[model samples]
Target: MAVDTTPAAPSHPEGGDSGGEAVRPLLSGAPAEEEGEEEELDVRYAPYARRDAYGVMGRGPLSPAQVARLVLAAAFLLPLRLVAGVFLVVAYYLVCRICTLFVDGLEEGRPRLQGWRREAVLRAGRGLSRAMLFVFGFYWIPMSDRSVPNAEDVHQDQSAELERPGAIVSNHVSYVDVLYHMSASSPSFVAKNSVSKLPLIGLISKCLGCIFVQRESKGSDSKGVSGAVTERVQEVSQDNNSPMVLLFPEGTTTNGDYLLPFKTGAFLARAPVQPVILRYPYKRFSPAWDSMDGARHVFLLLCQVANYIEVVHLPIYYPSEQEKDDPRLYANNVRKLLAIEGNLTLSNLGLAEKRVYHAALNGNSPRALHQKDD
Candidate 1:
């Protein structure tokens, strides 16, 4: 039988008077491609995300809010550093006095005991210095990276030729270089004697087996630095510690994009001179610059300073046994090695083909301090 094909009564577009309404698209009034494009172009924000368009490492341009907050924070914290510095100095002096008395007592009628007690006092000083550094590190400085080599690796290279202690030479990028080396390895420093007069900081340096030389004053004073280095190597051997001395060959801080030629004194330290290359993620604002005036510059830096601080200990170099006595040639080879490893170009960081003495290196020069120093 032929079935009847008849249409039902028409319903309204909105399903008026019907049991259920017609289904509509979840996203209405936009084509699929258009919807996708809109989603792709959306700018998302996360709380505390780093500000964009700034240098990855150095402080970038700041907004008014950032500047205001930075000022307020500095006003709150500057006095604290001052107070801490003063307190540390007083306490360190007292401790030194007590040790001196004990050493004097030990020396009475027992000459050999005097030497032992002297070393013990020095050891205490080194420990205190390290403690101070830890305290300093906890300040608003946010370190991005500070990884050391595996203990196994540090040992393997140092052990290759155990005839004498090896020297580690690096570019002196900042005062933080000292702390960085201390944190990674216990090595004697090749430093200038002027550092010994700096109150609390000077005390810490002395404790760290720092060989202080008069960079300008010659004869005995100059010889003292090298002599101390040799003595330190002997001390390390007696203690059965890693054979290494930390040497800042550049003798000063730089932008860090280009390494300054080394000061050859470091090569005179007994050993196979190992070139230790320390690099921050950004060459401009590593904590190494922390000692620069320590007030105004730090104030500007703490206020949204570099995005991060990174220290990389590059390869260890062992100069041929022949070059140990000839420091200049030793330094030249180490510099050449670093140049090759860095693969730096003149325009790499907008640096000139040759380094020129900028006012920054001069102690009396007006610094890039944000606030005027009266």
Candidate 2:
């Protein structure tokens, strides 16, 4: 029987796949070949073979010494890390609760803690978040700030009217990305609505003034979220004291090796944004959140004796006249810059391709899912 090597159609939603570019298919596996025929697979699809993004499955089986090391780490380090991590989290939650006390309308409108209360929360949050990362074995983080000075400073042209940096945009790789950002700059994030209901995190997220949205909704609900983000971006640009809004233009996590197509919501306001790039250089297990479950990722991360992270802070990106008018152009241009500077491959795949890859990896048919919709 001839093997079917045809690529499945990507099922991306509107506003998800930017630029309407043709996305390379996310292949689950290579087709079977005849007895003596050598199979040649494209290197691009190597990341998708294991059904998870970032090719954790492709890392192959562990060596005997590696297994012994993991065993020892699991026996000793895991317990200490767990206890310390939990303690730090609970302590931080108490601090947030106290800081938010007597402050009304926090649960209602856009929560912005002012004066001493804001300072208290930001300081405590940053300290505790760093402690938590330390407990997880991120002892030291090396950061590179390659950002250029503001155009206004370089050129004495008041007529230019360059926008101030309103938001910090970065590619999402793992949940750990939030901790680093919190410690670096306590900026508000764009998070899922469900995150607001999570036990310890929900309250903390609200205190950080996280903009919540339903990720699954594609109708007017999404548009409302976009408008809210734009308004917040504008507010940040105008108010020097407002917390910088942090947005992940990719809208989802990847393996940290590829940059996905960006969603235009972050660029809708056309405000200047500080682009940040985060990388996890690991020898054994990767810290990227692409295909791993939260529990397993955390457990493995703690099991390791040490972990490494590199953060690159690029210069503030101000949109040009044409880019300001076209949000897509602005988003794509930023994505391209990140890809080149970060040495990450540019992928046309978006959230939809990720879902399809996940489903196929787990023994489900993506075509069947699409068939039901049809």
Candidate 3:
């Protein structure tokens, strides 16, 4: 049998597709060794390839048609979004209030709560997160992969000493990642230290057991965080419901096109680690934070009718003999595994470098809003 080898040219209306993401080839310049092998290469990394060269916030000027769409969307959604934002903030505050009273140690200098009181707090946090997601039109698409091959199910790992997720390492991109992860795992995050000072947000984050870290922090600050992560991971006992510590190893956000270099912080712990991947698919507005101001990003996201998030939770990785001894190697190995599974290509640049790149492109620092306060 002879197969048609000619490629079919794509035909479209004046406007191209806008529903699903359009994936492009990440690999180029390689000569095809054999027929059909080029296609295999294209499809390999296609699912996570980037179509635009610039970051999400560098979406450039909108066309007149796009401007009209934005205006219309804002006219219809502005009032509703404001109301929803207020309602969510009030609801979150109330929930945190309840958590402080009932949840042990959440009140500060207190011991851990026993039994139902603790459960009540956990349930409240999860419920609040889901409510926030609902208000923002963020919905998760669930998927998983097992590079470690420890078991078929997450629950099955309960029998092993690993038990429930002790530490979670994920690729960072958006603020919404916290909401999704909190709802899913009830884990404490190793967040940016600035998060601990953001008014009501900071207070609530502490109540939720979040561990905030200073970026590239050194001396006592780094040591303190290292000890904290170690303590949190070690605290995940045999109980399946015990809390897990979460870390975004990229140390900052990207446009979701490339996987940034992984920081070695999370691997400092000896406990079992869980790798998580998150992608927010968008057409109207991207949820990925880049050079955009925070307030503008929030408004853009809230104005959208619907937004989709994709989650991939890989199996819990028990440290091999090599990983057990070397945290740096362990971090790199886990990062490589995630990049392959997530269909993400590794980028040499980290978030700091990206910020500089963004500034050069825009002729202003991405941190301009912050600098303005000075």
Best by lDDT: 2
Clashes of 2: 1
* Model 1, global lDDT: 0.45
The TM-score that candidate 3 achieves is 0.74
- The parts of candidate 3 lying over 4 Å away from their true place are 1-59, 102-111, 144-164, 192-199, 213-220, 237-242, 364-374
Candidate 2 is scored at a TM of: 0.82
TM-score of each: 0.55, 0.82, 0.74
Which ten residues in a row are the worst by lDDT in model 2?
34-43
lDDT of 1 by residue, 128-153 (tens): 55554444443223332322334454
Local distance difference test, each candidate:
0.45, 0.72, 0.63
Ranking by lDDT: 2, 3, 1
For every candidate structure, what is the RMSD over all alpha carbons to the true structure, in angstroms?
Answer: 20.3, 7.9, 9.4
Descending-TM-score candidate ranking? 2, 3, 1
In model 3, residue pairs whose N, Cα or C atoms come closer than 3 Å (at least 3 residues apart or on different chains), thus clashing, are: none
Worst 10 residues of 1 by lDDT: 42-51
Candidate 2 — which residues are off by over 4 angstroms? 1-60, 150-162, 216-220, 366-374
lDDT of 3 by residue, 99-184 (tens): 56644565442236456655765787788778778778875455555535545442343446444556888888789988888887
RMSD of 1: 20.3
Q: Could you say which candidate leads in TM-score?
A: 2
